[model samples]
Every structure is written in structure tokens, then in C-alpha cells.
Target: MYSSIYGGIIRHKFPLYKPNVNLEQLFGKHILFLFSFLTHENLNRAIRGGALESTRDVTIANREHLSDYLKVRDEYLYELDVHLDRFLSSASKAKISSPFSRSALRSILIQLTAASKCKKGTLRYWPSAGPGDFLLSSTGCPTSAFYAVVIDQELSQCKEGVKVITSSIPMKPPLFATAKNVNYLPNVLSVMEAEEKGASSSIWVDEEGYIAEGPNVNVAFITQDKELVMPPFDNILHGCTAKRLLELASKLVDQGLLKGVATKKLTVEEAKAAAEMMYVGSTLPLLPIIVWDDQPIGNGRVGELTMLLSDLLWDDMVAGPDTQRIPVPYAE
Candidate 1:
């Protein structure tokens, strides 16, 4: 973990992550599940305290922070510039000031990845409003702070298909939805709804009945006409991976594998009728959706074109052009 408040990367004597046998046992027995009620006369005053130290951040009280989490593969940061650009744009939208310059932050992330020796995982960073008084306005906050962390994990292309449901939770309004902010309560509820119904995740349909996106990933569809279509970015987060997939899909069009590529508004009726469906995002890159709302999506199996597109993305992530992947300066 790297914290601007700490002035650099925080060293750990042990591995950054480890499976805890105790936590496993506790969760297995559902011991942490709570069902209790307590009455306190000072309950109203309980919300009047705030922390002024960076160690205890105001992130819980303030919902205006911005972030970017990107994949690190083979000691390289994938799509570094694209993700940084989006991160900065999001910061501008949220009015959060970055403690470091963009170039400095990029350098710090690369250094952090190299230091962690994490070859296959994610690098997530954030620029928060910093510690401040508990108030709706951020006027009490001092300078903003930045933090980044690297996780070590296994990475592989997603081949199997998953099911999805139409989210009953209301999607965020266009103002908040367009920018990547930390306010994700509705997204969390939408996914929980899907899980309760035995689905992998859920998709958001706008107030107008147009296909919006998945909980955290962008949705793409392949029409029976062999066209690759994605919902426009007007009311959704402009996904860096999704945009790159669009650029790469052009190759399919050129080779006659796909009829065309487009970004347009898609209705639920039009979307559910598609020959293939997939979710596009940073990690999964591409996840095939074989079923939606219990109905078989085009024969109830992973679409061939969907995997082909996944291969395109996977190959690019592993061995794409130099512009898309940056080699980390790991110490020899």
C-alpha cells in the first residue's frame, strides 16, 4: 500500500495478502451475522463526531472521492495512459484535487507495482477529499490525499458464461452516473438482488427502458445480423476497456467476422433478442452472458463470437502494442 499521507509505500514484513483460517471458520459458521437492537439516548449525537487524521479518513462521511483500478499483467500496467486520463477526468468532475501531478502519480503507481512484485493482479488508487469534519460540505477538509495499493492474485481470461437479471434498483441519475464516484450503494443493492435470485449480476435499464449497463461493467451485444453494438456512454461511465474493445472489434469487421461495430441506445426488447451478450470492464475485459432473466440467450450457451472477442482482448492485454501496455521498472 502507498499512502501520500505516509509519504511513500508502506512496507509489510509479511505478504500483502494471506488467507486467514480464522476468518474462514467464522464465515463458514455464520458467526458474524448480527441480529440485535440497542437503544441509546445519545444516538442523535453519535453522528456529530469526525476524524481529522488521514489514518481515519472522511471517506465514510463524504461520498465525493474518485478512483481508478487497473490491471497489472506480466509486470506491466495495462492501458496506463487511458486509465490515468479517465481518473483525472473523474477527479475534475468531483472537484477533488490530486496531491501529486499526473505524471508523478503514474510514476508512483509503477514503482509501487514493481516494489510489490505482483505480476498478476490489480492496481487501485484513489484521490480523496481527505480527513475533515463530518458535514455535507467539504469546506472543513484540508488538502486532498492520494492512496494506491497492489494486490497479488491469479489472472485468466473468463471463458464460461453467466446469468443476469434486470435490476429493480433505480440507477443513478445521469449527473452522478456519468462520472466514476465512490457512491455505489445502488450498484451494491443491484448486485445483491441478483445474488438473492441466483444470478451472477444485474443490468440497469434506464427510466426510458433503454439498456444502461451492468452493475459495474458495460454491456455489449452481438446482433443476429453479426453486428457488435454497445450502449452509448451518454448516461453511463465511459469505460476505457469497453472503448478499446470497440477499437479492436473493427478488426473483426474487416475480416468479415462481424458485420459492424456501433455505440447506440438499445432497448430491453432489442437487447434481450440479441444473438450474443457480454459484459465489458477492466478486469473481466469480456464476460459472455448466456442467459438473462432465466431465458436462454441465443441457445443458452456462450456465443462463439463472444469468446472470439474475448480472445482479442486477452491477447491485447498480454501482448498488445507498446502504447497500451507499459513495462514496470522492476529491480533486477
Candidate 2:
């Protein structure tokens, strides 16, 4: 049961979304059930504020006008499933070395598409939680529609003991970084930018110039003095993989392995001066970022602290007790 404040009143309820069965069998069931669960979850969360019930009603009414929201959500799910199956099947037969194979990327796309259908809003995922990796555009699909996809290792490369992970191809807006339903453009561009800049990868900046994230990963750094640094949550995407790393960091702090973990607003300049840098996501557990914008980060190489955290994160991801569970409502 998840609980939060709404209208200054405490609201508690079981999660609206939950997977009834393994997500691998998503296409075998009715997609509307999934959308309804997501819708209920978001609404309940919004209602926590207590004054937004009327607004919620209005939003639902407006959503109906945009088209059959449920149908659209189903379509998105179907498309995502199709893509995932294709990617995964192909990957199973291919010799892919990327952290996340094309199949993983497709799975994330499905999740994002489903979430967007419920909110009628748009969402973007960076390659490594830096800036722009591969973005999905669903803003034009419906007035009350949202689309998002995760950027992972399907677009990365390595060289000279440094692994450079780029986003997509052709770095530009509308076709690249601009928010939309399609994501391939930015994914391609971010990777190209990394290659051209001679950096391991490119970090994306939001409208305010704050380090938003990476193409398909989340950014984190360790200061020269060995302090863990990350951006505040307000402007960055909420990365599940990153969240896991933070949890691990908390445990490390408890065990006295790390000095501490800090989540604050950090500028690019501050990050560049940090002793070590890395990116985190579902696919790439932890990847060192030795350079940014052609400027050598820290020692112009992966930092020891960065590697330590990476190892810890990787160990947990591969064998941690935490099992992936879908929210209720989406659950069978």
C-alpha cells in the first residue's frame, strides 16, 4: 500500500497498477486493464493534495475528447510488445556486447508508452541520465497523451580502456532531442556527439542548462575529496536503476565504506572538476565517464571511487534479492 498527502489529507490505497503475470506475457492479456491501473494510480497520487479532485475530473473529460485513450494505450502497448519481441528474439541470436541489448530498450519503451497513455503527457529518457540519448515522441499522438523510452546500451561504444556510450544517431532537435513520440533521432545523435567530441558520452542539459541526464543513463560523480554527487530530482527523470544505486550507496554509508551520498543541484563545471564520473541505468549498471565536452573529467580517466561504486552497483543488480514487481492495477 502506497500512501501520500492529498489536500492536506492522508490518502492510502493499494497500488493501482500490478502485473497479473510475468510482463513477458503482456500481449496475451487485455491492455486496457493495464491502462486503467496506471490511470487510477496517477489519479490517486494527484488526489493526495486534496484540492485536485475537480481538476482530475476535468482532465479525464478532456482525455475522452482527445480520442479513445484506452484504445490508444492498447495500441502503444501492442506496438511496444511487438518491438520488444522482435528485438529480444534477434538479440538472443546475435552477439551483442552492449550493456542493454535492443530487447531491453524495447521493453523500456513499452513501459514508457503505457505510462504516457495514462497521463496524456510526454516523457523522455536519456541514454545514461546525462542529456539526450534516444527520446520517444508521443506528444502529437493525442492531446492528453505522453510518450517516453529508456536510453540504454543499445547505442554505446568503447575505446582505449574507456567505454564511451552514445545515445542514438544524428544529434538535433525535432529529429533528435526535441520531445516527440519517436526516439531514434536523439539516440543516434547523442552517440554521434560522443564519438565526435572524443568523449565517452555526452551529458544532456535541460532548458536551464542544468545537467538533466545522459542519453540513456543517469549521471553521478565523486568529488576530488571523495564525496558522491548527483543532481536534485526535480528536473531529472526518476531513474529506477539510479534509485537502486542510491539505495546501495546508503547501505555503503551505513557500512562506512563511503563518506556519504549527496543529491544536490550541480553545474557542469562542478561535475568536470569531480574526481570521477559515471552513468547509471537499468542496462548499464555503472559506466565511467572519463571526459565531458572534450574536457578531461577528474584524472581524464575513470576514478577509483567510481569503479568501486560501479562494482557494488553491478553486484547488486545481477544478484540482489529485489525482484522486479509491476505496480498493482497492471498486475494480473
Candidate 3:
């Protein structure tokens, strides 16, 4: 498994410590702590009751295991209400309103759960201002968004071999790209567009005409000279999965397993001429683009770099955090 560093320190380098044997007791304590934290009044009461003073001494003993402590802290943060209506109203006024349907939210959450190796579930949809903004602003929630839409045939042919899945209706960008709050729309639309074009999915273009990413995934390409390249973050959503792949790419470059991948504002012509192209995201980890806008990408087939990156990404997913343990089921 690939290693990660936070704050310049390798995560794995930290010594591991097993949790207390009495899991129930530990969990109870966690709940109590969370309750106190969530209710400031209660915390003040606890402080007066000597609870805070006693805990301060105990906290020092667990400082080394701060990561685990932070995990528990995050759980409490998630428990806080998101005040969705307030956010929605604010987003609407800002012209960043979303057209997310309940079905779309359910489908996306299910897909993410599966992709992230979590349980089957649905997530709450919140309106976002644009691609750069996090879909879910609440702390400890899925930061990404989902879109499901239909792409024009012309755009679908940009990538060869990838099929698009079209809906009976011309799926609007709200279900796919252009919406700030929902993220899954792009993935669904990319797939729809690809199936519609007799390909697998649609290839996305940034404002500069360079390949930004696929609907729900990020794009990576190897130039004719075998230089690996990924799109800069300016034009696309900062995909968590994509971030991880980039991290892996850095490692691969160090080992000479692959050329150093660079992010830049690439033009459409530059992307189309690349020797290889692939899509990366939560669900479709790495899908090679054999064609672009009816033109053959590379040799009109999946390239070797695409496969290598896909394999590397899969390994990381298996070793990553367990997203399912949080259990964000559909709201009743």
C-alpha cells in the first residue's frame, strides 16, 4: 500500500496503539464527550462538576494517539445539524441553486458507498456555488458532489471506446456538470453521453478547451513523449480519488515506474495528441479514452499508462480509511 504524509510527517510512521479492550466502555465515554462538546452548556456544567478538570489530566496521556482522538472528534462534528435549508436559500440567492432530485442523491450515495468500500446508502444533497466549492460544506461529510446528465453527441465522441449512457430526456447539466452543489451529475452524464455516442462515457473540457476531467472522474494522459500529465485544479472539481491518484503518480515518478506527472492548463489539441488518456474517480477508477470527439485518441485504444495508474489507484483504495463505518443513510 502507498504511504501518505500529513503535515510533513509520514502517517504510518506514528506508532500504532490498540484501543482499550472494553470497547463498550470506550464508546460510552466517547458519546459522553461528544454530548458535552455538542452542548456547550453541558460542558460548562461538567467543568463545574470537576469532569473537565479530571479529563484534562487524562487527555495528556492520549496525546500520542491524537489521530484516533481526532477521528472521534470528527464523528461528533458530523452529528451537528447541517441546516440544509439555510444553505439552500443562501445558494439560491447566489444563483448556485441545484436541481438535484431525490433519486439522483440516492444513486450517487449508493455508488460512492460502494466505490469508497462503504455500505449501501444515500446522502443529502446541498446546493453549491460552483465546481471549486465543496458539495457538502458540513465538516466530516463527503466533500465531493454528484451529477447525472446527458451530453451532446458532439462532446461524447471526443473520447473513443468510452460509451455514454443517455436518458430518455436530454438530461440537463444540473444532473451532470455546471451545478455547484451536486457532484455525481457529471459522472452519470459522462456515462450517459458515452453510451449515447456508442462509447463508454463523455470527456469533459475546461474553459480553456483542455481536457479537465470526465463527468465524475479526473483525466490523466501521457503525452507522445510519454510524459504523464493531469489537468490543473482550476477547471475541475478537486476529486478525492483523483488527489490520491496524483499522490500515487508522484511516488511512481520517484521510482521511475512512470514519468513525473505534471498539472497544467492543457489545450484540447494537446490532450487529443497525447499518447494515452484515462479517467479517474470514485466509481470508475481508471477508464482509458480510446477516442476524442470522434477522433482517435492515441491509437484509439486504452494505453499502458492508463492501466498502470488504475492498478496503483486500486491498491490505495483497499488500504484507505473505512468510509462505511460512518453510516450516512438516507434521511427519513
- Largest TM-score belongs to which candidate? 1
**lDDT score at residue 231, model 1, on the 0-100 scale:** 98
lDDT by residue (tens digit), candidate 2, 207-266: 554566776557888877677878775544445557667777876677766688988877
Candidate 1: tens digits of C-alpha lDDT, residues 1-332: 67675567744232222334243243233222111112122342111111112433556566557767889998889999999998888888888888889899999989888877667888887788876776766787886777777766567889899999999999998877877777889999999999999999999999999999988789999999999999999989999999999999999999999999999999999999999999999989899999999988888899999999999999998899999999998878
lDDT of all predictions, in order shown?
0.81, 0.44, 0.43
TM values, all candidates: 0.87, 0.46, 0.46
Q: Kindly provide the TM-score of model 2 when superposed on the true structure, using C-alpha atoms.
A: 0.46
Candidate 3 TM-score to native: 0.46
- How well does candidate 3 score on lDDT at residue 154? 11
Clashing residue pairs in all predictions, respectively, total 0, 67, 41
Off by over 4 Å in 2: 1-184, 324-332
Ranking by TM-score: 1, 2, 3
Residues 1-332 of candidate 3: C-alpha lDDT, one tens digit per residue: 00010011111111222333342353334221111111112232111110111122112222110000001111111111222232333355334434454454334433332222212211222232222212233232222222211111111112224632222223223222322333344456557666766776666664445556665557778888777788876545555556667777876678776767778778778877888877765445567777766777788777766777777765543343453123334223
Best by lDDT: 1
TM-score of 1: 0.87
| Candidate 1 clashes between residue pairs 3 or more apart in a chain or in different chains | none
